[model samples]
Target: MEKQGQRCSGLVLVPCPFQGHINPMLQLGAILHSKGFSITIAHSQFNSPNPSNHPNFTFLPIQDGQTDHDATSTDFISLITALNVNLVFPLQESLAQMIKQEEKKERITCVIYDAIMYKAEEAANHLKLQTIVLVTNSAATRLTHFTYPQLQAEGYIPPKDSMLRDLVPGLHPFRFKDLTILNFPNLEALLQLIATTIKIRTSSAIICNTVDCLEQPFLAQLKKQYQVPIFSMGPFHKIAPPSSSSLLKEDTSCITWLDKQAPKSVIYVSIGSAASIDGRELIETAWGLANSKPHFLWVIRPGSVRGLGWRELLPECFKKAVEERGCIVEWAPQKEVLAHVAVGGFWSHCGWNSILESICEGVPMICQPCFGDQRLNARYVSHVWKVGLELDNELERGEIERAIRRLMASKECEEVRQRATDLKVKVEHSIREGGSSYNSLDDLVNHILSI
Candidate 1:
């Protein structure tokens, strides 16, 4: 590691332009900046982060050839494929200009890019610059990327409905239906993306946004497969100083509402930025929260509910039912919401970031995964970690109500709450002076400096 007061190297970070992917990469940038590295954020123009929020770092915008409509489009695979093809040359040109301008004041060290933004790695490689890959998902999810080909070879990719309940042969605890592969619509395109992402190019090290205690087995498997150093130093929101990286404006009024509620009495519901629900499911969710007998804070992101532009389409009856007990917002400051004392349970989509935040805060979850790694994450949360319950069946008001009550109020779930609390304690320890994440972070910084 660089000496405490020494000038550290300048590092450029290229984040995938999505809420989930952008948050951790920026948080990572914050962490490195605190460690004395000069930070440059080279991001795509579409859904670009507000530079004002991170004024300390230099922001470099690369033309991604995406319009506002493209950014708002729900077709994830096509968007990703287009971004990969379009960003390569512009990113390379940006990096080239940066090197020329900053060569004298602060030598550019390496480019650290989100794994999904493989083109960033390509651009940096063309410039003969060192690079590091940041895996923003769980180690378990990353492991599936390696095993997908094998699963396909065994004819399990488009799994039979009969086999859905069975556990995968090598990847234990993951059922056929729980595979990330089953969630995407275009199998060939997703598989191609995965193949390209998993290939090792010029990266000197790999960094994961996961805790070692929760994913030791998967981390061990990954270490055996890759030649570069692997670092598990995360729950990045906790490691980095607090800052707003939200693409959508967050309503802080929810925090005030949470304050008025009784301790451990609220259920926080947010399905994440990308996932969408049908009108019927949204209606069920509204009624469920209304009848669940707990104070609830729900995020109904604009355009997240199909056929409904926002939350306005909900029936007046459901609105009246929840009028007194529920608070709904377009988006919430989730970290703040999860950390609140009134948030006893989370009804989440099991996005890795949300899972880590919930674990860090000692809040039990009601796992309702939507797609991709979320399915696997929900499985682990409810089964492997034993800190949450899953909603496996289709959305129904009664089932939703029961799930919420079981997680937030039932005596039977005290054990789950206790386990969540224990994990929270462990997460706290992992960031302390002598802990796993702390040591891993030191190793990562040293590795970056060595490059």
Candidate 2:
């Protein structure tokens, strides 16, 4: 075991209390810990880390005064507001306690926080500690968040609810329909979050989980405008393997099921941690999956539907029909499942993590975006990268069946598959030795140490 005194320095990581945010922040922590840093995770009480999974890292669960069940009951904007209001003092107190105990042996050198949890940054600033903002989404999404005020002032937002295509200057191929944040029900609260997130300008540097090749233009513009150094050191999961901080117990059975299927023959469907579909849409999706007639592995989280007891609502006939060909689980070991030989196509919500993982595995996507960065990610997947097909808002069985067949069997899909494979090669190379992501990680480590 590595002794405390032998470690070079201590670092605190504050991830937002969400599965998507927690997983990447913990992966980054594991990567840094491998590089001689003493990893300390100071997380909110809501969605706290399972210490058993990360035994090496010191876990400090800062109280956000939220119960485990709050995740299902509380609305997103309210939860975010409560987190900012409640967690700051506990975070500062935790850092102070750590400093008092370990300062002589291994001082807490810096605090790396999720940019979404801007309150953590405020606390770090108040303590006069060095800080690095870890951005968990795409560079394009980050640009959207940062430039939201400009978009509002320029009269591009509060847009008509119809899907007419328009453009924002400097954000080409990203049309009015692609703007996700503005469509939120709580637009004011989201704008407030954006305003707070931009205070990341006060941090020592910004660490984003995106490679330059995928989002070069946004990264370039961000670098030129911001004084702080922006390090695009990712495809993060590849950099640190077997490093998942999932709040749910992933079903490993999916892997065993995948083993029996033919190569590149299964559609892997997962929407992500926090999207819920209405009753009609859920029924449509069920019919679509059944009509597609391809082998599939789908994740239907317990509360992913609007109605009570969603399991009872899935058509009995449809369930019986697909039982032989489809597998349904609450959650699966996603990275492992994606890399399985049987997964040829992804039916996804296009969360940044899922998108990168699919790209890494050379799997083409059938994009069905729900909210937030997903819309933009789908746009890029279908339009810019040409590695996926985007679904319309109306979830028709025919459209869904057609998309699956095209992605799985059509001649046009071969080109998409090849494009995804080529990008997979590029992604693999980026995280390898002396590549852009590798060099960026090295630079970030040095920058953190210097502070």
Candidate 3:
């Protein structure tokens, strides 16, 4: 064993078993590793990390107690329930063993876990480890979750299907209907989990993947509610080194396709990893893409369509119409695609990572948020930031066509383009030396060392 002074303390990161969650957590691990911390990733077996990809970090897979059948389920609520129950014991045992063996050298210092994976914090507390909660989405998203109790008390949730006119406090310009939860099997259970997680997380340092300039008001609100040190270190992917943590096999062929397109002429379309569009909606979207007639690169990942075979859903005429102008792939190298010169607008699900990436690339957007924090994200994209336009819930071919046209060719698109570009520069600067995100990273590192 190396001497205590010579050995770097270890940090265990517990990310929720999803692409979005895993990417940021791995990025954080890479960031911390660069800052002289020994990185150990304790993850669920549901979506296990390839240890080969990140050789520097030790990967610990805790049996999530999920059978092959349950593991294959797309029902996120059930999966997370199983994880919350099954992860506690294996993680406890793993942490206990690591602490026992590594205390003399490279001692385990802290467990910084995903906000959703609060069970890891419980395990860490049982082992007397310093814990921090890593909020993987925008601060605005967390702000909404934190304010759920108030919304529920005011009967603002379980919103009506009608276009809501009433506004939720702090979530202005967004109607009550926009606050609906997605894929949650039990609403009460989800609420309880959020409340409990927020309570537990408040006791420690909270790290968010958002910059101060992006969500200053929300961050300020969070500070007012909780006394813990809130570190807004983000565009985490920008600050951290480049690494491939994507669960899906990314198709880099889109890059070559983009090289042939005219500058600021292509629309990059991705609905995110987990969202499943209805068969009718898929057809509508296809027609919309065809009607818009812009050079487009669309990612139609397997399972994105609800039906068993979605390839044949689009009409032959629609397919033929887009054949000359569109490139369809299974998945995309999103960051590189967004940064490409040909990508002028993004038709996105408004996932926080996607939002940041789009902002980083100065690409305006047509927001088609599906669920969870995405609705709120869309609100901010369209209303708060004025970088995107949100689509209605019902996916109509005309609406889709209009949105693409508006974003790609409308005169008003210039203003949104300017705003997106401005934010891109600001976001880039924030990750540079002495900027808000840079300073926050330093403060977070020092806090972990102190603990």
Q: Scored by CA lDDT, what does every candidate get?
A: 0.90, 0.86, 0.86
- Best lDDT goes to which candidate? 1
Q: What is the TM-score of each candidate against the true structure?
A: 0.97, 0.96, 0.96
Best by TM-score: 1
RMSD of each: 1.6, 2.1, 2.1
Q: Per-residue lDDT of 415-438 in model 1, one digit per residue for the tens?
A: 999999999999999999999999
Per-residue alpha-carbon lDDT of candidate 2 for residues 141-179, written as tens digits (9 for 90 to 100): 877766678878887667775644767567888877777
lDDT of 1 at 402: 96
lDDT of 3 by residue, 1-451 (tens): 2344766779899999899899999999999898889999999988898888898999999988888999878666677878977998899999999977885458897898987887887898898888998888877777678778777787766655553656877777666766746435678877877776677543369889999889999899888877789999998889888888999899998899899999999999899988879898888988888888898999999989987557788778887787769999999999999999999999999998999999999999999988888888898999999999989669998999888889999888998999999988898889999899999999998888777
Q: State the displacement of the C-alpha of residue 95, model 2, in Å, after optimal TM-score superposition.
A: 1.1
Location of the lowest summed lDDT over 10 successive residues in candidate 2: 1-10
Model 1 CA deviation exceeding 4 Å by range: 1-8
Could you tell which candidate, 1 or 2, scores higher by lDDT?
1
